[model samples]
Target: MEVKVKVWIEDDNRNLVFGSGKNEILKYVELTGSISKAATKAGMNYKKAWSHIQVLENYIEDKLVITKKGRGEDSGSKLTPKAKELIELYNQLDEDIKKYSQKRFEELFLKKDELISLKEDDAS
Candidate 1:
């Protein structure tokens, strides 16, 4: 089956923020070692993105990213252990879901035409 999968956490504002995006931000933080650069690549302003990170940290009850004062371009931002774990979890969950979907729908359900027809009719 051709299924699309999505995973996210909803905020107090009912916003569906993706684990993937946050993970990418963490990756960029590690690569560039700057929250500012990470936020920019994520198409977010630094302060606003920082605020979002803060919200997530509060939700998880742990610090995700840490920033440091730069001494003439020798310092920047980095992801904490919590952040790495969160990202790894996000990736693992996503993979598991995808695998399950393929096994359940594409393989197992492919032969179940009667059930699929009923579902399609109900949708229409």
Candidate 2:
């Protein structure tokens, strides 16, 4: 009855880099400014969350966040400009792809179904 899609970015080795899951983690980190807080918010283990971030940064060859060593407001994780850009681009691409897929699905599958259903209704 409807179309669904899951989009992600991968490296040349087909390594998963960015997707909805990582997107959520990054968004939470961007909000909380702490990996621990982000992990808690996402209901993920802190180590797993950190590992995921590490994988993303390693694969992209960029620093996704900067963490300062302190206990005051000046010390917390902050997303880099590149990380923000990557998030924006990935979100846009995912949305655009889903929109295109739904449009095509309607044109091809739903339209045909409507025609067939109408034909049956007329006969009955």
Candidate 3:
């Protein structure tokens, strides 16, 4: 068997502000410095990626990315300090949850051999 985990944050109004997909977009944008490039890397369209960022910003009531326009080479998106902090916190939370879930899953479900042996003993 396998285990999967997903984590996200919601605003006071219960609107989702951050999650795996958005996190990937944010990380990629930070790495590539361009929303368009990040969206391409993430297999999403520019519009969708921009929409996601906008939703997150609205939910959090903060601007997570600084956008620059024009055809200059320096034109690109950059993550705000708030965005960086949020990404770091979200990543840490994701790691902790994955570790906890894996440990619990092993304890509860990965002992099939032991369970089978116990069943055989009971049958005997």
**Clashes, model 3:** 0
Provide TM-scores for the models: 0.73, 0.85, 0.81
Tens digit of lDDT per residue, candidate 1, span 47-124? 877777887787778888877895766567878898888888888988898888766776654564433543655777
TM-score for candidate 1: 0.73
lDDT of 2: 0.87
Provide the lDDT at 108 for model 1.
51
The reply for model 3, stretches above 4 Å from the true place, is 11-14, 112-124
- Model 2 segments beyond 4 Å from truth? 112-124
Q: After superposition, how far is residue 117 of candidate 3 from its true place, in Å?
A: 10
Candidate 1 — which pairs collide?
1-106
lDDT of each: 0.76, 0.87, 0.88
Using TM-score as the measure, the top candidate is 2
How displaced is residue 6 in candidate 2, in Å? 0.3
